[model samples]
Target: MPLATEMFEGHAINRSAAERRAATLTARRSVKKLHQAAWLVNAIRCIDLTTLAGDDTAARVRRLCAKALNPLAPHIKEGLGLGDMRLTTGAVCVYPTMVRHAAEALEGSGVPVASVATGFPAGLMPLDLRLAEIRYAVTEGADEIDIVITREHVLTGNWQALHDEISAMREACGKAHMKAILATGDLQTLRNVYAASMVAMQAGADFIKTSTGKEGVNATLPVSLVMIRALRDYGAATGYRIGFKPAGGMKAAKEALAWQILMKEELGREWLNPDLFRFGASSMLGDIERQLEHHVTGRYAASSRHAIA
Candidate 1:
């Protein structure tokens, strides 16, 4: 199935050139608001955590990035409050090299392993190397694989090449889920994000993700909205329920809440499950604990309640 370009069926109807342009603009803007709602809703409501701490520990960022996710993954929901919101047992993520480490850290727990691959943050490696990395990650017990597309392909107008590569990566994930990271910051346009989302889905990505957590454009609501809308249309057309993952820059519980809202408006109840939605963060767990505590006790816990792996 060549990913359907008919995602814009309703908006792609025959019309005057001006009308077509207006519809395109209008559709883009509408898609824009759906994402805005994701952020806005977060400001209002709930999560696991969404921080990578890449900046907080420059000296130990590499080791810290691997360790930060450990405590959260061991017992994500263990310390959760009795309040209305929910959280993961732990949102465990690790470098590609540690897929097994992450797998061990999360062994019996329900927490799943999300391993980054494909020369992430800069999908410039040869396609053969990227697939091998993905295969190794999945074999090492990664439940999910996050791979980056060739940003150059999307920007330099080599979309066909990009599409072909994404298809290969998706097929490489025999069972584990595939999350295609757009690195939307590099694309620099919502229109491009929308188009890329469509291409990724047709190519077989199980989830459409934002960013690579490299101090670049780490996940934005608007970017998510565009992708989700395309996914929504993709689902309606193909009956395929794709998933979404937002990584980087989510550190607070409040931000998680907004993502919930974004899911509601764009993807709806069909995707509220952990299978359909997940957030990737490095330093977000402990803070989620603190936020949950604050919501209940009026005053925050004086000490950190985060569990150490």
Candidate 2:
């Protein structure tokens, strides 16, 4: 796991082939009725229900935590016959400063508080500053730290620099899990995405994230396919399973189903669980709730009824 450039240096990702495979994922695998409801429920468990706005407040974070705690309404939970299932989102993600509020709100509920550190959505900050940010978030009770990588490292083919930076951040994280955000949209090419993913895993990232959700293009299936393949390859070589998270620009139950399908087909059904996969979403849960309501009552509910906050 020590900067294995031989694993991906000359990797060639056929763009057209990736697109074609991504296009066929949803069409080829279809889940409907009860099966669809089941998959959506599983997706709810794997969601990093998030709030990362510039104006985020403790009150808003508390409300989001409330949602993460009880994702389904009483009526819907009853209709689905979950029977004290205690369903909750995988984690609640917020900015580093808000970690304490979210941690307090979700305490004793078996839900983790994930904080975005190291200058989220952009890793242009100084290295020491970034590591300090990770430590600060950990001190604030963040169970997971989502750190962004320097896109310039990937762009300029500085694999050692990238590995060393991520390795330092990982050490700063200590016991807290670290998710390395590739910001794949900024990486320019699928091959870069693959190589960045490999290096992040080699450097001790517990997870490799697709985007920060700020880029013009975030979490496209083709880009995700390349990343998944990289993780799959890394697992094959190291026997260490790394998690995958697709963040940003996803807001539909259908999209959730599609990504789950991709994980199932590529990495087996084990990846469908929260420990292995997560959807970094805020709005996607509302749509998933609405779809579940429709599945229960055979009638679509108004979008406002499923507001996350």
Clashes of each: 9, 0
User: How accurate locally is residue 190 in candidate 2, as Cα lDDT from 0 to 100?
Assistant: 91
In candidate 1, what are the lDDT values of residues 44-75, reduced to their tens digit? 22222232333433234333334433333323
lDDT assessment of candidate 2: 0.94
Q: Rate the local accuracy (lDDT) of all candidates.
A: 0.64, 0.94
Output the number of the lDDT-best candidate: 2
Q: How many steric clashes does model 1 contain?
A: 9
Alpha-carbon runs more than 4 Å astray in model 2: none
What are the RMSD figures for all models against the true structure? Answer: 7.2, 0.8
Instruction: List the lowest-lDDT window of 10 residues for candidate 2.
Output: 300-309
What's the residue-level lDDT of 185 in candidate 1? 79
Per-residue C-alpha lDDT of model 2 across residues 1-309, encoded as one tens digit per residue: 578899999989999999999999999999999999999999999999999999999999999999999998888988899968989999999999999999999889989999999988788999999999999999999999999999999999999999999999999999999999999999999999999999999999999999999999999999999999999999999899999999999999999999999999999999999998999998899999999999889999987777556
